[model samples]
Target: MKTFNAKVNVTLKKSVLDPQGQTVLEALHSLGYKGTENLRVGKYFEVTLNAQDENSAKTQLKEMCEKLLVNTVIEQYEVHLS
Candidate 1:
């Protein structure tokens, strides 16, 4: 087996309101970052797992994303395996 690294990015769906993003945008404006017009908040996760190959790594990542990394009702997730 080989060890692989997976990077997961989870974010709220476009239709959902992002209060944290809004707060960050407001802060940017207040801090004189006038050029910043928008912001979005999300989560990132790095995981290392054992797998036989890249395909196996990806499969594991997909399962992990579906089971624990994403809230399907309101969020989306992307997985990158290396």
Candidate 2:
């Protein structure tokens, strides 16, 4: 087995309302960050796990996300392994 590092980026679906993101965008605009628009807030996770290979690592990471790390009803996730 080999140790792997995984990054999971979880985000709300585009169809869902992102109130936190909207609030952050408003704050940014108030702070003179006018160039920023349509900003969305999301979650990032770094995990270390043991897997047989790169494909296995990615699969494990994605399964983790689907089973517990993410809300499939309102959010989606992407896993990157190294």
* Model 2: lDDT to the true structure: 0.90
lDDT of 1 at 59: 88
Q: lDDT tens string, model 1, 1-82?
A: 9999888999999999999999999999999999997788999999999998999889888988888889899999888877
Q: Total clashing residue pairs per candidate?
A: 0, 0
Candidate 1 backbone overlaps, count: 0
Against the true structure, what is each candidate's TM-score? 0.94, 0.93
Candidate 1, poorest ten consecutive residues by summed lDDT: 60-69
Question: lDDT score, residue 55, model 1?
Answer: 92
Model 2: per-residue Cα lDDT over 1-82, one tens digit each: 9999888899999999999999999999999999987988999999999999988888778778889999999998888777
